[model samples]
Target: MITFYDILGIALAMSIDAFCVCICVGMKYNKPANYMRLGAAFGFFQFIMPVAGAYAGRLLMKYTGNIKYLAAAFLFYVAFHMFREAWKNKECKVYLSDPTVGVALLMLSLATSMDALGAGISLALWDGGIIWASCVIGIVCALMSFLGVFIGKRSRGYVGHYAEYFGAFILAVIGVRFVL
Candidate 1:
């Protein structure tokens, strides 16, 4: 059974990507409405992907027999990639001149929510409530994304980058916890 703490941790871990991208958007486009649009886009996708993944996971569960190990492995893989990205601190170009609500925002939202699909699969393996978990994930992501933009607008440099590292550590610990 997945506890509330576990769900919260996973949600936070998943939101890191959305948060980071929102920060970049915020830095480039400081419009208040743009922040809401970004948040809605990110949150909505984050909500949808997990539910889809959970359904897929349920379909596979009968054949797999045990999904805990798979979930742990997937979490570890996500954590590893997150850590790698944080270490590299790759430069991403955000077009300040471009419209905030269009293909670019849709693509960003889709990119960030991919991890939630994996997380949804993991949640299904753990017998988690996909709807509830997804709601929490969506709400948290929305709030984080909204806030990230403001933070980015106010600050410069790599101040918010540490969030990815922290999120990675949380995911890694959760993965190990599941294994043990």
Candidate 2:
């Protein structure tokens, strides 16, 4: 069903934002538990945003069907940009070298998951079960984000560039598939 695919796609798309940010944050922290906390925070936000969006989306029925396409377009655009950056033979750089904890993490989580909020609106329009979709999104984001942080901490040298390119590629592919 469209709902299922939308839920899956939204989960993947939204998770990437948190994943990318979390990876950068991982570079700042030495303790492993910090990574877990970031992931959990991201997961929680990713989960909540959609449910809220879905509720709001239901109130605006006219725009529901179009959300997927919009999300896909946005994702593809991001992916292409990342891919271009990666393809360029430039030195890898860290954007947020000093990630904050607690309040900072909360801010980052909410900010990054904005897309998920939009997707949640779409999911609500599709009559997707909020509980199930939120849980899935939460779990998917938690796992991917945790992995991203782990990998970033471990491979501090060359992984950042690759992660961007890979994430971008994934977004583009998902977008193209949705458009098709």
Best by TM-score: 1
Tell me how candidate 1 scores on lDDT.
0.84
> Please, what are the lDDT tens digits per residue for candidate 1 over residues 47-113?
9988998888887787877788888888898898888888888554566564467898888889999
Q: Which lDDT tens digits does candidate 2 get at residues 9-72? A: 6677667767766666666563678777877888998899888877776666565445666655
Q: lDDT at 35 for candidate 2? A: 70
RMSD of 1: 1.5
| Deviation from native of the Cα of residue 88 in model 1, angstroms | 1.3
RMSD of each: 1.5, 3.7
* Pairs with steric clashes in candidate 1: none
CA-RMSD of model 2: 3.7
TM-score of structure candidate 1:
0.94
